[model samples]
Target: MSARFTRPGAGTPVPVRFPRIVREALDNGLRIWTIPYGAIPVATTTLVIARGTGDDPADRHGLASLTGDLLDEGAGDLDAIGVAEAFARLGTHLDIDVGPDAMTMSSAGLARQIERTLELLASVVRQPRLEAADFARIRELRVNRLRQLSRSAGTVADRAYVSAVFGDHAYGHGALGTTRALEATTVDDVRGFWAGHIGPAVATLIVVGDVVAVDVAAAARRVFDAWDATIGSSRIDRPVVAPDRRIHLVDRPGAAQSELRIGHLAPGRSTEDYHALVVLNAVLGGQFTSRINRRLREEQGITYGAHTSFDFRRAAGSFACETSVQSDATAGAVRDVIAELGRMREAAIAPEELAAASASLTRGYVRNFETAGQVARAATQLAVHGLPDDTFDRFVPAIEAIGADQVLDVARRHIRPDEATVVVVGDATVTAEALTAIDRPLQASAPEF
Candidate 1:
């Protein structure tokens, strides 16, 4: 007997429901969230501290990032090698990430080793070695990396773009501080930053795996109970984005291509129009089949690729379009990008286009909960952004509910093509004549790295 197989047809996607999360707060003020998944005998833990580069002192721009790097280099009684061995013994690895709004220390291991993992994490957070030699070596490495970035056109353009858009705001500088600032950072400065920013009051511990939530919570209590309750200043004042549109050119002599960054301020992650913005962005430039890429790469043959994104932060974020093209074609590429942004706002999208964008977004949403670790990370982001616990459950419905009118409405309200700050990194001498069409006097400056 032979069996027949048929290709699956596209069906309406059912809403996704995440595993129930057990939430609790400890005596020391650490928020503990646990999700039990028995599909596999593994567990992942993430400790998110609500302190990041945005809190760096004005004079010490990379303080938050540097502090995160040194946490596991030597902590409690373990040296850097000792710390590595500890995780190796548990058959796992420790990962650290520093961003604009927070820093996270994460690890995944066998479910049976969850207790030992939490102990190691608590030591790294509460009892960092903060040794002088480790600090010196790490700072040198970071300074060297920053110097290398100065030679890359993409990096220079990105740094110049953010600085131009934000001005003196805290978000202006890159997480990697300026060369001068890194040079000035001292061991004492790093120690002070750790003492001030790290504490239970501003931290949350998230655990997800094939383990009991009650047991996990008890284990966390035993390890982190005595941790300090001191809270740091984590509030970010809303940045004042000046409505000034201008073309700023960074002179990168002898460059063959121009790196362009065009952007303006937009709503944050918690906006009510989040779903509409996502759909709009997909049609505009967020996807490979987006209008910007099709127009520039396929139709015009001007660049290899072009894309746009919203850097959604805890506060107001920026909408940016990035691309690289021949130095001679810089002005034309910029005009095309600006025109596309305007078209998204002014024109009515076709029903087929809207359907494609919606499907693209919702189809990918299922990947968020394919593993315990991903679920935990998603939950952590919800907490970070002050979103409701059921945000994931409603995600598909929200995307499905978006109409073309709503997407266009959000585009019109959020995107401001006329107020964009354009940063161009290219051979200024070769591109001078072509850039004159931008209608703004070019402000020339050396790369500030």
Candidate 2:
């Protein structure tokens, strides 16, 4: 007879020399952070604007994102096809990411081609032709995406939850926006947003891998220094949750599963309790072995998996648990999820749990700097949030130092079960009665999608 044993435990935490970053600025205000990560011959160049979807006019919810989609369609002397072919000729990949807080333009290619890639990116941002044909085509594609989002339970729950949490605030709507808002969007709107929000004062240029700071700055100035247009630099007011709003749902008729989002508005990215909150989330639902997942997925068998996150932006953020479960188990699953959220504040954290969570975060922290692209992305966060240059240098030790009491304090301060907003997308006809049976009074709203 033989006995089965679990796998080996995590190794002793090791020290890593995080990339030493050089911060330089153009005369016009675009910050340049160049990190020399060599031996790979590849470089990733990124340009970021501090404004993103949250900066979209309340009336024009998707303007920022739609403008991003049109950036590379036609630029400078190149038509849509020509622009694509130009980047292809350089063997570079161009990617645009528009999130709640910022818009990132990234190009990754051979180190020697980095200058040309930067030139192409500059053309897209500074001189996009913004052709009528491109706008109509891209706008239609976005409209199609919004249509499809209505049918997916996960997206339905996501949009509903965000809306419920923030109400009509700028952060309330998803980047894709509602059908009415997207349909009403015009090319003139795209051009206007481009002219207003894209500029050096609000931008940060980060170059990583096999590049020197002097060269990146020289190329950046040559391309962008003379272009000093910086408008729409206003900050987003911190969002407030609707006091009376508790539970929100979108009816998905005959759906077999229910997608749930439970959470509330929490502290922003710059909180002093950042490290403790990280450990708190790791214990709550940020990891597979977390409290919420262990209770709902491993013990009760209600969900396949469950996860939580603290989405930190500049001025504000959210703490949420997301999962999909059988429709019949929605109420019980929601109850159990809320209970675990409370448990963090209501109960003492076990020493093993604290050690495991700290290990989970610290052990793999170094992996974030393994590639040039990874470094670019990680650095983007620092620049976008106006974090100090030494953030990466302090990450592992910060997480390792979070103790049980500190995590509990952050959990109590940030995780708000009482104010939590519950969002579910499922067959409401079947879910309504059970949801109402729980201790929390339930409220329903028509799908916001």
Candidate 3:
């Protein structure tokens, strides 16, 4: 064949072939999954608990996160620093994450040290010291962090946006919570939260690496089986979009730019059209070449970049197109964003656009399992969301098979431009009059700290 001058086009992506998981469980009901992956003699261990900020009591908004922070601050035979040092010695770090629906803590290192790693993870989760001094320090840090976030325009927009959308529902509050609730929280409250919420009955252990499933189960059992504590019931909230409370503007007074969060409540993580939503978002603004990003950033040059996400969680979620634009571009950007939303609902995507979005997702699917830590975390998602074990295995093929009509259908069903909640955190002097030009009513909102 003669040399071709034009660039080559991307071919069909090879579907990801997922490994079979070795699933086990302790008598206490803590499920264990072993995902054997990678050639390196390394592994990752993770414990995912089905309790989080959403489980916080009405008056105790930030308790779950507070409890998470207290873990590893002096456990079995080590203080927080010692716990950290031990993991460092193993060539890894202990990562604890508190999300809207679950709290997950993990560590990765040599598969040879997997047993010790499990022991350390056990100490942090099952027998955290939760000393009075450590509690005070973590509480102070949370307060300081909230105070700092209050001053951040983007953070302010997020807080007000969720508050306005979810109202007083459990999902309404931010993870860090307000200073009012934090100041009222005490160390005893923390201990009570731990006793009532953390247990084997509500958790799953996932180990992925170059190791045997049986050995991993044995090690995990010795460490996690004795966590016979009773886990308390979580708060049940049916969060819906707050009606008649449309545009919320939190004035920053003379700020140079405005942070805008536009959109409303969406389906939870386990929505039936999950694959379509992924491709739909990728085609919308999930990527650099998406419609909104292209119109706002590439064409008009109003902002540096624009993006959107379907923040799917356990029970409910939100769809938002977030962007920071100059003070003068605020109103135009708002209108442009809404127009794009309407366009997505009404328009059928071009063939090339659909192909690119599908490729973007399928081609990168296997990379998620490239590392032990990544594989362990991916497995944790299955446990947390109650998804089928074949979820990852089905991802590439399902995404590749998503046709233009499916995306159009989900877009029409989900994207609500008229019902979208518009929020701006910026200089009200210019934005107030500018945003008023839009159809929705503007209501001034303040960060609820």
Model 2: ten consecutive residues of lowest lDDT: 240-249
TM-scores, in order shown? 0.96, 0.97, 0.96
User: Candidate 2 lDDT, tens digit per residue, 1-449?
Assistant: 33456656899776667788988887888888899996988899999988799988888888998889888888989988898899899887689999988999998999888778888888888898988888989888888898888878788888888887878778888998777887788889888888888888899888999987788878877887777685866678787656533667678789888999999898889989999998998999999999889888889998889999988888888888999999999999988988888888986699999999999998878887889999999889988898887887888888888889888888888887887889888899889889988767677776554
List, residue by residue over 130-206, the lDDT tens digit for candidate 3: 99999999999999999888899989999988887777788889988888999999999999999999998889888
Q: Over the stretch 241-264, how does candidate 1's per-residue lDDT look in tens digits? A: 786588888888898999999988
Error of 2 at 290 (Å): 1.2
After superposition, candidate 1 runs with Cα above 4 Å error: 1-10
Model 1 gets an lDDT of: 0.88
lDDT of 2 at 66: 89
What are the lDDT figures for the candidates, one per model? 0.88, 0.86, 0.88
Model 2 clash number = 0
Which pairs of residues have clashing backbones in candidate 1? none
Q: What are the runs in model 3 whose C-alpha is more than 4 Å off?
A: 1-7, 235-237
